[model samples]
Target chain A: MENQKERTTIVLFSGELDKAIAAFIIANGAAAYDHEVTIFFTFWGLNTLRKDEAVNVKKGFLEKAFGWMMPRGPGKLGLSKMNFAGMGPQMIKHVMKKHNALSLPQLIELAQEQGVKLVACTMTMDLLGLQEEELIDDIEYAGVAAYLGDASQAKVNLFI
Target chain B: MENQKERTTIVLFSGELDKAIAAFIIANGAAAYDHEVTIFFTFWGLNTLRKDEAVNVKKGFLEKAFGWMMPRGPGKLGLSKMNFAGMGPQMIKHVMKKHNALSLPQLIELAQEQGVKLVACTMTMDLLGLQEEELIDDIEYAGVAAYLGDASQAKVNLFI
Candidate 1:
């Protein structure tokens, strides 16, 4: 096994704050264990990679509505549970900070620092009418085939 | 590497319908690939294992309130998103049926039939005021140590 390279692939399918945090935590943990970690963000998960500032891009009505209704970035994501009209996430974040836990953005930065590869799904971007400029810098872009190529070789593949 | 055992451990931490479906889907997929898969249900995830029938168990005010607020079993669990005051889950279920996808209960049965080990977290059971008789039969029960023991040797470890 010493000659074998360990790899972990995570298909991040959820854009909720807690789920995104879990994905990054797992990716960072795998990287710490000396495994090559790749996270493929698709559909709603792409919101995590979106830039906080709204980009000036032209789009159809529905696409623009989606862009407006959905969370713009990690900071704007709502909690999967107890989201009492958007107040639950803020309360949770406060509790997390009180306990000295890393914020979701901090976790993303840490994962990147630990060499965890972040890949945005190009198909999802197209469907959502998201331009590359609307996303954060320092990330890769690919489709599902590229993700499956990595997943096929990974000993651990998760759809989160 | 050829001689190594392929083990996958999943920590089911959320009780939401969508998350539970994802867990079973992943568990079944791993089993299809001949991996030894274990799903440890903890905290809210234990709600998935609850029987649809309400058990006659006495509890304190807070515990009774907790039980009342949370969904009783997999059949009653809500979706993680688009839950429009409970209508969204039914809508999603209808769509899944239309697409010939298995319901959450069917997925659970399939996963078990495929030899996925379903383990209930004993600590969570105690914390949530749940009893052994309230859950489905033929599943294992243990603490975090047992889960960590499996996760340590497993090639894939996920907290869903």
Candidate 2:
């Protein structure tokens, strides 16, 4: 029989642009190394998977407040440090473009094309009052148990 | 031969109080499960290992600025969210005390008592101009290669 592919998992727990980019870059690199990679987005990390445009979804007051308050999608995320009222992300994007490095959105697409599994944490979605329609297409929804199962089996598991 | 202990590693990359607490909680839990746990402190996360009082180590102007600017230790870190000019940490500390949860310092002591390996990233120390004298005792200093080696061998590797 053929050998099984090595597995890697990342729990994306931060919502900032720089952290998300770091998480995706690592995930893509692991996928390139032929690992069966899974990026499980939870808590504020779920913001990375949101669609850019506003989604028409009915929600309670708190949920609506969350929707309005949180950044809509990857393009809207701020840098974790040196944000300087959102200018840090712009500088980072410019530097990435100049260096010929893939932007975070492009890196994410590359991950998807590389068959890296993207799983959104359902429990966090519930907590953040986010709906499936509000997220990008072609991702799976799961909870902590699923993540724990994957992480327990994978040698490279990161909570980013 | 006896079974090998399950290995786990965590890269503490955030310096905030809440993140440090979370990292220690997970590390402590994994250790309790009989895993050989290692927490490699890097970047801002190295602040978690610092001594509260100022150190007499000589440094350049830039390094001195970094040392002066960054939080002194676990007790000085701010919350990641809702910092409210440092009030957030105080509130959290009060609540943790009320709940009888171990404070961050207590958690670090417990980690030490449990023989959990605490490694400070030497590369980060150099970058931030932190001398060995500035950090707490009973911990190690290593670079990224050492961390990658541990991560590759461990089943659970988290970057927090």
Predicted structure with the largest DockQ when compared to the true one: 2
DockQ, Cα level, model 2: 0.27
> Which residue pairs collide in model 2, if any?
none
| lDDT tens readout by residue for model 1, A61-132 | 646866887799999998778878789989989999999989999998988898899999885576556888
Per-residue error for A142 in candidate 1, Å, reads: 11
The C-alpha stretches of model 1 lying farther than 4 A from their native spots are: A1-6, A17-36, A46-160, B1-4, B58-62
Evaluate model 1 with DockQ and give the value: 0.11
- lDDT score for candidate 1 against the true structure: 0.84
Q: Distance (Å) between predicted and true CA of B35, model 2? A: 1.7
Clashing pairs in 1: none
Error of model 1, residue B46, in angstroms: 0.4
What tens-digit string does per-residue lDDT give for candidate 2 at A45-127? Answer: 99999999999999999999999999988999997765778876776676567557688889889999999999999999999
lDDT of 2 by residue, B12-95 (tens): 888899999999999999989999899998767999999999999988765786788789999999988999999999999999
Global lDDT for candidate 2?
Answer: 0.87
